[model samples]
Target: MGVLSTFLVSWLGKDAMAGVGLADSFNMVIMAFFAAIDLGTTVVVAFSLGKRDRRRARVATRQSLVIMTLFAVLLATLIHHFGEQIIDFVAGDATTEVKALALTYLELTVLSYPAAAITLIGSGALRGAGNTKIPLLINGSLNILNIIISGILIYGLFSWSGLGWV
Candidate 1:
């Protein structure tokens, strides 16, 4: 929520707070599905690991992979097909640039769903094992990587470097 709020403030500005608020309202609808999958995987993985049942843990991990894959595919399809409409519905009379930027951001964001799912699984497994430091390190490292990548991609900061070939 803090990240979203920061993004809303930074991207949309204060004038569009109402629109951002509405977008967040619609986002909560999708978050319901996300919460279901996330909570289910966390519970199953934690319980299995708590019991020290490696076989059950493995099974739960496999099941979560399958489920998350399906969800990623479904979400990608939905975003690809109806993303513009959804954005429009949520944004109402927002500025065209803001709406377009929001849609593009959403499209780019979905591409990371697989990585997010992997991180979630890893974190869940670590939580089950009662060792959270590793997961925290993993998440922090990924966030740093994301910031670096986003800076390069969005700002063309490394365009001249040409992967050190120049």
Candidate 2:
């Protein structure tokens, strides 16, 4: 999605690419946090399952989900609220267009963090359950959906203007 975002709004010029990259870099921090939670969940659940203690595994999974859910929501809210300031601070030398687009991208993508967290943590649970294929398939499907949506939103269909690439 990061690479595609640059392509999607290429007409906006190098500024769009810089903005997308900046937003993407900031977003990666959120992802890294939840990814750690996901990894920990996988390890804990796998260990509990190894001990043949399904109850412990369930507890571990539920706790991770609850914690990550709240964390995800809080992270999303903070990013959505402070995105412009954050972008400005991070890209101090960037042009106003780049900074503004970075803020826009950050704000728009911030809300999806919760959903992303749920999926990542759920995938971790599945990994513990020894069902890696499900997560692979889920992520693949989501990627396809993202490509299609980005295409439609960037290039437009029918007579629309793709909102002029936002």
Candidate 3:
């Protein structure tokens, strides 16, 4: 999604793309929580299943789900609150215009962190359940949705003004 957005926003011009790409990099860092949850959940669940200990697997999965969800929500709130500073901090020596545009983009996108986390956690949980198909299907749907929404907001379908400045 970040790569696609880097290209899509390129139509906005170079500074726009640079800012967004930088912010995307930060977003990826935040998303590392998903991988942590997935890895921890997978290890515990897989270990339990290997030992044929259904109760342990179930307990670990439940505990991990709660902790990951809380962490995701907290992270999303932090991003929404301080996302501009984060953008600026990560943008290095980028021009002010680029930083402003990136802040605007972040404003439109910061709330999505929690939703993405839910999807990520769902994928992890499903993996723990030993069904890879569901996670793949869910992630596919997420990618398609990201494209559709970003297209609408970035390109302004139906003559509505796009989120980005033209």
Candidate achieving the largest lDDT: 2
Instruction: List the candidate 3 regions with Cα displacement exceeding 4 Å.
Output: none
Q: How many clashing residue pairs appear in each of the predictions shown?
A: 0, 0, 0
* Candidate 2 regions with alpha-carbon error over 4 angstroms: none
Look at candidate 3 and give me any clashing residue pairs.
Answer: none
For model 3, residues 1-166, the per-residue Cα lDDT tens digits are 7788898989888988987887778877877867777777877887888899999988888887777778877877787788778877888888898888777776666678767767776677668768799999989988998888888888887878777732
Instruction: Report lDDT (CA) for all predictions.
Output: 0.64, 0.84, 0.79
lDDT of 2 by residue, 56-161 (tens): 9899889888888898899888888888889988887999988988888888788788888888989998899788999999989988988987778667889986
In candidate 3 the C-alpha lDDT for residue 88 amounts to 72
> After aligning candidate 2 to the native by TM-score, how far in Å is the CA of 128 from where it should be?
1.1
**Best-fitting candidate, measured by TM-score?**
2
Candidate 1 residues lying further than 4 Å off, grouped into runs, are 1-36, 158-166
TM-scores of the models, in the order given: 0.74, 0.93, 0.89
Q: What is the C-alpha RMSD of each candidate to the true structure, in Å?
A: 5.4, 1.5, 2.0
Report how far residue 90 has shifted in candidate 1, in Å.
Answer: 1.4
Error of 3 at 92 (Å): 1.8
